[model samples]
Target: AYMNEEAVGKAIRRSGVPREELFITTKLWVQDASYEGAKQAFETSLRKLGLDYLDLYLIHQPFGDVHGAWRAMEELYKAGRIKAIGVSNFAPDRLMDFLVQHEVKPAVNQVETHPFHQQVAEQQFMVDNGVQIESWGPFAEGKNDLFHNELLQGIGAKYQKSVAQVVLRWLTQRGVVAIPKSVKPERMAENFNSLDFKLSPEDLAAIATLDTKASLFFDHRDPNMVKWISERKIHD
Candidate 1:
């Protein structure tokens, strides 16, 4: 949710949504990757959101003192402040490393997953490791003109769905969780409606062929990306 305090406060208050019915998730920014810093960041996020506990907490990136931050997250989970803890943007190797070294296994591993960048091997690894796969860019953020792609559009036409809906449904059908963002209520409804229909095995295979096995966005392993991320700081 981009860590905007005011937006979160208003969302919680205006919706009047029961906490249990809602799955609230927030990330521990890279700047707060230390042991104590992670603890303080968690408390501050809770205070800002006016919540007693979080539904899901995630380490935003794979960089920095991740082990230290994860230790704090593990404690928070044990303390009942966080129901589930996970990591985001972690490659398979790093995710497995964290899982092996830590006492508590991560409940989820969120990454960029779409028809264009299906991440087949990574998804299989997460599945084998018993970690839930969540997609950050299910629609590829319109990269490579994903919305207008003939393959996805054709698949959607079969079920009277939009390209975005088809993409979301395809991911969920593979047991992958998707977080599709849209400011418009109609678009939000469209994304949610994906659960109403099911894709056939043939259709799934057709969509699978669209996988390029690469990220449409910046690579996490790139030195430039690392430098850019390391320079930023998120306030407590």
Candidate 2:
């Protein structure tokens, strides 16, 4: 919701790429986590992105009137305004409740996932529930020196890949969609190249040892974090 959709739209318009070849996704912010608010937020996001329809639209968080927001999203999906609708930062309990409460199930659950804070159980939970697990912080935002991690570096050495590529490949091997952000063209290309090779079973097992199973970032279930997140407003 805080993303610069206008800039993304501008870039897309100038890229000479067809709309069908690109998949655009945006989310409804906490302030607009209500039935009518979600409708307006969807339109606002669409206008900002200069798009007539969205490939994926997610409720940014599990807070606020989530059910109401889901209702709005369901209506939009049914109307073909959004091809898919899902959520982010939703824990298993919240996600289960939402699933039971709603008619349309979530297509994805984007959460903090990486080698350091490997969401193995979380990913399996989403998998069992038929939701795709998408990793937001696949590198842990450089926390704990993920770039120079010896385990990752050793694994990369085996495949003649960079540490970043190794990490991305590991996530891929686990069937989680890792969105490892990079600014440099070379880095982006390297990230894309991770799909070329597969991590061996031994390499995968070794990477699994790097998992701490705890988020390097703040806990989403913490009361203080929830309060802080819910208090923030991006809209006028």
Candidate 3:
């Protein structure tokens, strides 16, 4: 998400933010999912970001040698190098399978979630398994003209908040962690201020009705999607 070493370095320098106060997260790319490769990748990421340890590290996807990667991550966690280890884009079934086989369960599951694609079932499953659900495309990447949605706007009017803020607050109120991205500082502040207002139970229920229960993006279960993602190498 930070893109590269330069971006990460710039952020670290400009923010002057303390390491302990920042919840830094990085991921092991699918290309580096093998057991040894995972270890190497972790070290590479640390060096690139100029950090001794990460607050959280995640398997970028459920592809490649995930079992081997998880084993390596578990070792890193036990060694106190990573505060938390998780998996991203893992479906409920894959998550359950991984949980059943491993002694160290995943701390978080990052997935595509928003008002449109609420992932209600998956969220409940994660709750049942004691895993935190984090939303990656929390704003749905602006799909369905999310910014101008009447329902979200109406809710924002009640709290004098922006549509984006309303959506973020809704997610957090439901106990889901949201990662909303913005290049502008003002927009970032708006998102950060979302926690200032609490949505009413009726408003939350209204937002819940917007769920289509289907991903606006690609389906991981589709064989074609799997092949497309698998053939592309992060470094190649």
**Stretches of candidate 1 exceeding 4 Å from the true structure:** none
Best by lDDT: 3
Model 2, 1-236: lDDT tens digits are: 66799999999899989999999988889999999999999888888888999999988898999999999999999999999999999989999998899999999899988888888888889999999999998888889998898988988988899999998988888898887777799999999999999888889888888888888988888999999999998978
Worst 10 residues of 3 by lDDT: 1-10
Writing each residue's lDDT as its tens digit, candidate 3 over 1-236 gives: 33585578568868888878888899888788889999998888888788889899999889999999999999999999999999999999999999999999999999999999999999999999999999999999999999999999999999999999999999999999999988899999999999998999999999999999999998988999988877777664
Highest TM-score, which number? Answer: 2
Q: Write the per-residue lDDT of candidate 1 for residues 86-105, one digit (tens) a residue.
A: 99999999998998899999
Q: Which parts of model 2 have CA positions greater than 4 angstroms off? A: none
Score candidate 3 by TM-score against the native.
Answer: 0.96
- List candidate 3 stretches off by more than 4 Å: none
Give the local distance difference test score of model 1. 0.91
Ranking by TM-score: 2, 1, 3
RMSD of 2: 0.9
